[model samples]
Target: MDYSLNEVQNSIKNNFASFCTKEIAPRAPLLDAASHEQVQTMIKENIKKLADIGYLGLAHEEKYGGTNLDLLSQAIAGEEVAKACASTFLSAGASNGLFGMPLKMFGTQEQKEKYLPGIIKGDIIGAFGLTEPEAGSDAAAIKTTAVKKGNEWILNGSKTFITNAPIADVCLIMAYNDREAGPGAGVTGFLVEKGAPGFVVGKPFDKLGFRGSPTAEIFLEDCRVPESAVLGQVGAGFIQAMQTLEYGRIGMATVCLGIAVACMEAANAYSKERKTFGKPINRYQEISFKIADMMIMTDVSRLLIYRAALAKEAKDPESAVLASCAKLFASESATKISSMALQVHGGYGYIKEFPVERLYRDAKLGEIGEGASEIQRILIAKSILSKIH
Candidate 1:
C-alpha cells in the first residue's frame, strides 16, 4: 500500500530522469531530420553513452559487467528514458529486455561470458527473432525451420517485424526444430551471429512511430551455427521465449506509463497557459476534468506496472499473467490519455514540433507491440479460468 519510492528507488528514478532531461530530451527533435541509418547510428552512440555510465548493465551480476540492480530500477529507467525519447529507449530496451535478459536466464556460463560483455559495454547490440511473416500472436504457427546438419544447424525461412534486425550483432533466432514433436518441444533457439553465411538483414521499414528504432526482416537461408550455439536447450525454446516476452510485456507497460506521464504533464502545462475566453483553460471544468482523469489514469497504471515488476523480480509463478494485465491496462491508458492531452493542445498537438505529437505516434505502438491487447486478454482469461474450479 505504501507507494512512495524508497531512497534507492528514488535515486535510481531521479538519475535516469535527469539524464534523459539533459541528453535524450534535447536530442529527440533531431530525429526528424536524421536519415534512417543516421537514427540507427544515433542509437549506437546512445548505447555507448549508456555503457559508459553503467546504465546498460542494470540487472546482471558484477562479473558479467552489470550493477546488479533489481527489476524496479529497470522499470524506472524505462519510464524515464521513454518519457524523453521512446525510440532510443526502445533501442536499448529491445536489447536488454528481449535479448540480454533471456541470455541471462537461459544461457550457459560460457555463452553468457562470450556474448554478454559486449552488450554491457555497448560494443554490439542484440536482437530477438520470434515473430515471423506467418506468425504474430500465434507463436506456434511460425514456419522458420532449423535442420540439424552434422555438427551444425541450418536455419532457413524469414522473420518479419523484428526489432534491431538490421543492426544487431547477435540475435536469438527461433525456428521449428521438429514439427512432429509439437510447439513445446519442437521449437528451438539459435544464437545467430550477424554476417554468418546465409544470414541476411532486410531493409528497415518506414513506420508510424519509433522511427529511430530500426525494425526489419531477417532471412536465414541455410544460416548455420555450431551445435554449441543453442540457448538453454534444443527443445525448450518455447518456454524460454514465453518467459522472455513476459519481461517485454512489463517493459511495454513501463513505456506506456512513461508516454502517459509525459502526455499528462504537457496537458497540465498547456492548460494552465492557454486561455479560454478570458481565463486559463484549467479554470474550466472540461479541461480540469480531463487533467484529473489523466492523473488518475497514470497513477493506476504506475501501480499496476510496479506490481508486475515486483512479480518479475520475485520470480513469481503468475508473473506472465500479471505482466499481460499490466501491459494491457497501461497501453490502453496511454492511448486514451495521449489523445486527451492532444485535445488539450488543440491544433498545435497535430504538428510534429510538439512532444505530444511524438507521444501520440509512439503511444499507439503500445497496443500492438510485444503482445497485442487481444492476445493479452486471452492470456489473462486462460489464467483466470485455470484458477477457477
Candidate 2:
C-alpha cells in the first residue's frame, strides 16, 4: 500500500513542525531545568498552547471540541511534538491521547459530554490509571477492587507510575469488580474525579526523563463513585484497556520516531560544522555512515508508524500486531540512533546543552512504556503463531 502523504497530511506535518519548533521546542530546556512544581505549571501551559491551536483534538471528532482528523494525522502531529520536546509530548500524550481516546471509544454519550470537551480544551487534564504497584505488563493481575455498595461502588487499591497523576482533573481507574469472573470478565473501569473521597494523589516522582510530565502514585482508600462513573459496563475494563493500548502503541511509536529524527538531525548538522583533521567530520566514512544509517532507520520507522496508523483507521485486526512491531522497532532504533548520533558529536553530545543529551534520556522510556520491547515480541510472536496453522 502507498505510504505517501496526501496534501492534508503534508500540511499537518509542516504546520505542526513549525508550531512545535517555535512554541514548544523552545520551552523544553526550561522544563528540564525547572523544579517539580514549576514543571507541572509549564506542562499545563504547554497543553493549553497546543489546545489553542486545536492540535490536541486532531484525532477526535468535532462534536467533542475536536477537529476530527484521522489517526495518521494524529501520528504525524505527535511525531513533530516529540521531536520538539519529548517531555511535553509525554505529558500531553497522556492527557489527550491516552486518557481521551479510551473515553471517546467507550464512554457513554453523557460521559463524553461531561469529560471530552473539557479534556480536549486542555482546561481539564486527564489521566489513565491502569499500571498498579504490582500490575504493569501483567495488567490482568491488578489488585484494585471495585465493590458495589448500594448505589455507589467502593474502590480500594493503589496505582504507581501514573502519568499526569498529580494534576489530573479526572482519571479512569481499572479494577476487578468480580474477581471470580476471571481477568477477561471480572475487571471494570471507573471514572473518578479529582477530590473524590478516598481518592488521593501522591507527590510527583522525580523521573529519569520526561521530567516535565509529572508521574506519581494514586491511592484509592475506599474511594466512592456513583454507578454513572463506570466506564461502559462491568467485566469490560480489561478488554477496554487492551484495545486502548493498541492506539497508545501507535502514539508511543510515533514519539520514538520524533526522538530518532531529532537525534539524526542534530548529529547531521554537527557533523558538517565540527572540523577534525583539517576538515569537517562528514568527510570521514565512520561519521557519514552513521548519519546514513540514522536516516535509513528513521525512514523505516516512519513507514511502520504509518502502516500501523492506517491499519488502526481501517479497524484491521492486524493493527495490534502492527502497533507492537512499530513500537518495538522504533524504540530500539531510537536508542541506537541516539547513541550513534551522540558519538558523531564526540564529547559535545554528552553535555546538557545539547538536545541529544535530553533526547537520549527520553528515548529510553519508549522501550519501557506502552508494552516494552520484550512484551511486544511476545505479542507479535503470538499473533504469528496463531496464523501459522
Index of the highest-TM-score prediction: 2
- Assess each prediction's global lDDT (C-alpha) against the native: 0.88, 0.91
Clashes of 1: 0
lDDT of 1: 0.88
Enumerate residue pairs that collide in model 1.
none
Candidate 2 lDDT by residue in tens digits, 359-384:
88888999999888999999999999
Off by over 4 Å in 2: none
Candidate 1 lDDT, 1-389, residue by residue in tens: 78789998898889988988887878876763478889788888877777777777997779989988888878887788888878877888778669998899999999999988888888979999999987989988999999998999999999999888878999999988999997656999888999789999999999888887889999999999999889988888988999899889988988899989999999999999999799998999999999999999999888888898898889899888999999999999999999999999999999987889888888999999888999999999999999899
In the predicted model 2, the residue pairs found to clash are: none
**In model 1, which range of ten residues has the least summed lDDT?**
25-34
- In terms of TM-score, how similar is model 1 to the real structure? 0.98
Evaluate residue 177 in candidate 1 and report its C-alpha lDDT on the 0 to 100 scale.
94
Model 1's C-alpha root-mean-square deviation from the true structure amounts to 1.1
Q: What TM-score, over all chains together, does every model reach?
A: 0.98, 0.98
- Model 1, position 182, has a per-residue lDDT of 74
